[model samples]
Target: MNKQPGTSGLIFNEPLLWDKSREGRCAVSLPKPDVERADLEKDLIGDAPELPQLSELDVVRHYTRLSQWNFGVDSGMYPLGSCTMKYNPKTNEVQAARQGFAGAHPFAGEEFSQGALKLMYNLEQYLAKLTGFDAVTLQPAAGAHGELAGMLMIHAYHAKMGKQRSKIIIPDTAHGTNPASASLCGYDSINIKSGDNGILEPLAVAAVMDEETAGIMVTNPNTLGLFESNIKEIADIVHSKGGLVYGDGANMNAIMGIVKPGEIGVDVLHFNLHKTFSTPHGGGGPGSGPVAVGKTLEPFLPVPRIVKELDSYKLVTDFSDTMGRLHTFYGHFGVMIRAYAYILSMGGKGLTDASKLAVLNANYVKESLKGTLNLPYDYPCMHECVFNDEFQKEYHITTMDMAKRLLDYGFHPPTVYFPLVVDSAFMVEPTETESKEDIDQFISAVKAIAKEAQENPEKLKKAPHKTKVTRLDEVAAARKPCLRG
Candidate 1:
């Protein structure tokens, strides 16, 4: 398998689609309208909207060349901590592209849609079993979308109890989307700082825990790549004040088989099917995040959950107080199809091994780079590891410099300056999919970078010499984005 796709010598100056337009060239030809030309002459035919006109070969070559310039999991290891950016199995894509599933329309009646509904129902049951939830909803399109639905249900639960809870307690180590979800539900987010151990303690939560709090949002294996050992105690404290506990399942890949959030006292949680289940990720893609809940909050899950009727499946909505529909129809059916295929192919043991290997690989890298880099936590990580620029700080080297230099090493850079707890953070997650050889190369590259930083600090300061472009002004790009030419 070639990591870098080769390009042909054929070149056309890389013109934009609009620039390729000619007098009347078109890749498609439409039959003349069935009605007379006079019918559309007055209004519809006044002027033709501007559209690119190109031959079929022209369009194909243009996109193919653009795709060659991009990198994906298939190209190499994408070790972005907390993202679970693992390799997507080609089998999933094959299963998703099957004509029956691909061509099926959502508006088709239940009788014509039995296969589709049954697949959704089966996937929901698999998720419920895995996460120990009473029920699940496949309505949310993505992870953050699932968060919104979960928070809305939490809001509805308290509203039904006649409690006007206005605040949601979130740990500082939780994902950035946690607070945004709470705020979307018209609740204020109260962020509490974690202790020195990078784990959120129950005592710290208890101080901020109050009757006005709607619930607490937490990531079990938090963004710092450390599991919150006091989660059960933290959940108890929140429950004592009659508040729910929402688990952000972004890190579920770390503890998929070893632990279940619902069994561990989480009232509600969501699953990033694309992340944990090995479906396609990123690119504003077709993603699914199914929200699961205990029986207490199950009534408020999005309406029209799938149910089995003897042998057939049906879409039914019957509950106490619902939050209504999050999507017009079942969300991202294609993504769900691919996810279901991944689960059946992997089975139970395979899934367990995936999580175990993820943890093992992360720990291996953490230990290997301990002295060369700066190990901030100095402990076993779940499915990812974190390091600061302590060793590089001596030579005035920064994490950004290290990240940029990784491109020259023939690897995508790990996430930088994140979790916002450690200074000059370098977060890396080598998912279970990578081979030992890939991991070794990553470690060697970092070790070389560390040596370079010590011996010649100037090389670290102005890095990424091998790439087509040198270091970019990210500050300028962020503060003053050029939207259009």
Candidate 2:
């Protein structure tokens, strides 16, 4: 299988569309005269825009080739850890793109867009039931936004009780956004070290809990791919200190139906619908992150929550002690619709089965590569596996070198040097949708890379030799970004 050249790879060889422009050639010829605007803002208009001039064929072929050069989950196995880039069902896309749902304006009258409102209302209810929470707010745009919303709710809860909790406890193995969100909410973030087994222990959490502790943000089945086995105990300690528990639900794909965060004493949680509920993640603007809160924290949830009253659905604008609106409208409605479709398609049993298969696939990869790689933690991983570069370092190869080499094998590299706790970390997540043959291909690729590292050290150093673009000077690229054509 040959790899497609990405945009970065095409920069050197591909001709710039602007460079192909001709003075008089145009894709379409326009009419000479049209209606003139009597009242227009002249200051806001530019004199002459430097527009590209190309034939229809040139314009069409350029983008078509570029599209073919891109890689996605549909094209191959995307083993991006913590991303859960599984195959998104086309049925969900079809449903979301339906005219009834997609074409409805956000400000349309409630009576005119009853179906969209109904879907949002029902999706909130379904998420609340799924996570065992009292209320759900589908206002945040993405996981990080959801974290901010959760932290704000925590702040509001503390303020309502006349408490001055000023610190948030986070595990060292958690996502980078955890501490950033806590800091954004004006709370001091306290870092707790993971136990020897790669899980957050209650003892470690207890040592950090105090009267000023705002809450603890933990990712179950943490970035290390191991479940926090002592989560219940950790929650107890925080709750005893009169603080709330915020579950970073980014890894919810591993235990969606198997475990509910609210049942384990979590007061608030956020769902990365783009990750766990099968929404297209990249290109940024369209992700949805809904927050679910238990009873104690429900009162402070973000306002403009959907409500069902007397068989009619409507958006509620006012609520006592609400945390206020995080977004302008009811969040990403199209993403929420896709998520609703995904939940309905999976149901309860299917969700549990998917989680089980995800765990099984991760464990299979871990066992297969145990001898070829260095496993930092000797435990069963849930949805992903973590390995370090200790084995490859013997051959003078680093994790970044190995990752770059994998790009030449027609596959996306696993996340490298993440979780910050492990040395030269390489995290791979073969999502549940991959077949055994695909997993075998990945394993074979890694083994072959290891062999190449031992046989020819220089080859790995100048890696991605077969790729259209070789390894870049990352530091230089960052310091001097060439933005203009």
Candidate 3:
């Protein structure tokens, strides 16, 4: 495909709908008013809202076009590392949208919503057993929310023991959410740098442990895609210092059935169902992040936990020291339904096989791109692989340039300059759902970009010429957000 050069001004086929509005032109005629209510106070009322006046078809076509511009797992391979943008099975969607599940109100009585409650209860048990944790709470809306809930549980656990721990330790390569969650929970985050090969050493953690340390937040097979082989030692060190171990289970897809965080001595962990389980992720979610805890931290779980009785299930709202409620209702129940469907559909062996295949896919991509890119770590990876821009630096090309050029080839780029540990990191996660052909296509695109970077650096710098939108002024967009049309 020949790529277009330079920018074009915003162009649209239809005139601005606002320009076509007449004083009394209405999209639809309303029925006669049955009753009139008293108007609000003048101060409470704003001037007439400036809404675009468009016919129904105009609005539909505009949104349809906008939706087409979106890139998703359904569209193609999304190699976003740690974000596991895998294909969400359509069957899960069918189950989620079933009237018996989707149409139920959150405020419905427990007795009336037995099926929904049972699904939630069974899901908690399944996840707890799968993760080797004593209890699970599905109150967190997303992975980050789950992290905050886990930290709060840790905080409450220490407070109950009459201990005053004020710091939470996280590896430098940990997700951005780890520190953010700690800060939100009134705990200071102590960042420990990982070793040169992207693994956090046990001794580094042990050296930093003090009486004030709450726990260590570890992301095994961490952001750099290297497993933390010293996890047992690290967990023991934190435990010896009276600090708990918090596992950020964002990368849980890599080790789903192979290992359980609790078995490795992690006291608390958050599961990103949207990432690991086949849940749709977009539009800031509707994501589920159920937190599982060991026996020690079970009492501090969030309120309204589902309890299965003799023949039925019930919701428990009262607790001695619960973390209150992390969400308005049991966090995103429909999302939980989808995840539950995924879990049951996959079964035990299927889950393990999925993990193995995911690891295999990632390794395949890693090995394929090794010579064309700079692999930061030498050892085998889990579900993702990390590469740096050292190979392209000689040509004055950057990871961003390569990423932008990928759009021209009809592929979304891997996450770039992340993990913050590497200089120009390009972390790729070719999920298990992608076929060998899809992987090869991505590999070919990346290889072509690498070649172009050396032969025609300027083309890479002015890349993504085929995308619907060209390069954006990201800094300006952040500073002056234009949210409205």
Candidate 4:
């Protein structure tokens, strides 16, 4: 068999840019200023800033080597559960970089920015249709932002009906941020536990859902990667109590064309464009989380909403019931452009196929590694699977140990110790982007590590021997962080 792709090769150790600085070196050559330098106020121009000085080649090599040290979806399989770090088509980036879209000013009048407006309008329409929602606002900046928007709108809906509820029902299986979003909108979170099958039970929801509760926040194909089959019943219960259902579309990659959240009793849904559609994500974003709502919640969507007025689109904020502006401007325009390009490029059929493949890939990983790892939820997963370290307990190994060992085999580790429900959780999600061969290699690497856990358990404790940096004392680092270099 071929060696794993993550095998260490000749790695270059690059020092900090400041460490390589030389007093007289410079990366660029410029002609003497033809115009006189303008004087700046002493306060405006602080003491000449400290900076690194280096030649052009020095700067180039420094960054080039640094890039090699980093791992991304482009580097190898990034099986991060709930984080769809798939390989987005490069064409999406190309479209986003076009001068007209890239250079359009945020403050440009609608007439001058017709193309941008039209794109936004059409993107909203597309998302609305895909999720089976009546209206969509591309204003929330991220998944959590969208959650807050949905909760605020729900609160507003209740207020308009002459009663503002004080609590929202959140299942433990929902996204971790669901409670935080509800709390941000002044609604106390009524936390409910999912049933033994890793999904919310209608009866459990019925037990606490009342007129005092605003609504329920659910993540379809939740963090555990299991679909809540009783969602329709749960939604009916919430609706009967004059409450709405908020769906977290973070895992929309699993059911894009298969099931629309709107048709499933969801009153409001938010799409993580960076996850569901293809867009750059991570590193604190540049993320887009457009919120979609059914007709009941449409009036409270964030404004100024983009509307088409006979061939020309305009931004209108006249709705008195709007949740008000969430972002300074339209959510991340670059992310929107990239997402729009992705949707256009991948028609409905293509997207459905992507979801199917994503689900298939995750199940493949789950079945392949179940023998080597402990799959806490041994049912069919949607686009990810949850595993625990129970099987490795006898070997005196742990999930973190196995995760660190993956680095030595040249593969990025799956998400470890998450979903919080499972002890020593190791969540893996091989998105549709990965091929069977690549996934098999990842499985092999994991199995090899498991074997090592039994025979050479001590070594697993000090794993990732090939990386530039070794295992860190994460606890100490978190407690006594080094604020300065």
Q: Candidate 2: which pairs clash?
A: none
Q: Please estimate how well model 4 matches the true structure, expressed as its whole-model Cα lDDT.
A: 0.91
Lowest lDDT sum, 10 consecutive residues, model 2, at 1-10
TM-score of each: 0.91, 0.94, 0.91, 0.97
User: How well is each residue in 1-485 modelled by candidate 4, as lDDT tens digits?
Assistant: 47787656788988788999999999999999999999888798878889999999999999899889889988888888889989999999999999999999988888799999999999999999999999999999889999899998998899899999999988888888999998898988898988888999889999999989888999998999999999999999999999999999999999999999999899999989988888866778878889999999999998899988887888999999987899997889899999899999999999999999999999999999999899888999999999999999998899999999999988888998889889899999999999999999999999999899889999999998988889999999999999753
Off by over 4 Å in 1: 1-13, 19-43, 46-60, 483-485
List the candidate numbers ranked by TM-score, top first. 4, 2, 1, 3
Q: Which candidate gets the maximum TM-score versus the true structure?
A: 4
lDDT of 1 by residue, 70-94 (tens): 6678887788888989997899999
| Winner on TM-score (1 vs 3) | 1
The lDDT leader among the candidates is: 4
Off by over 4 Å in 2: 1-12, 29-48
Note the residue pairs that clash in candidate 3. none
The candidate 3 region of ten consecutive residues with least summed lDDT is 1-10
Can you give the lDDT of residue 295 in candidate 1?
Answer: 95
lDDT tens readout by residue for model 3, 293-394? 999999999998888789898888789988788888788888888889999999999999999999999999999999999997878999999898899999
- The weakest ten consecutive residues by lDDT in model 4 span 1-10
- Which candidate do you rate higher for TM-score, 2 or 3? 2
Cα lDDT over the full model 3: 0.87
**lDDT per residue (tens digit) for residues 1-485 in model 2:** 32232223443245788988888778887786578747556677846578988998888887877776667888787898888888889999999999998899987878898898888888889898888898899899999999999999999999999976889999998889989999998999899899899999888888889999998999888999999988898989998989899999998889988898889988899989998888876766578889999889888888887788889988787889998988987788889989999999999988888899899999999999989999999799999999988998878999999899887776788889987889889999998898888888888888888899899989899988766668999999899988773
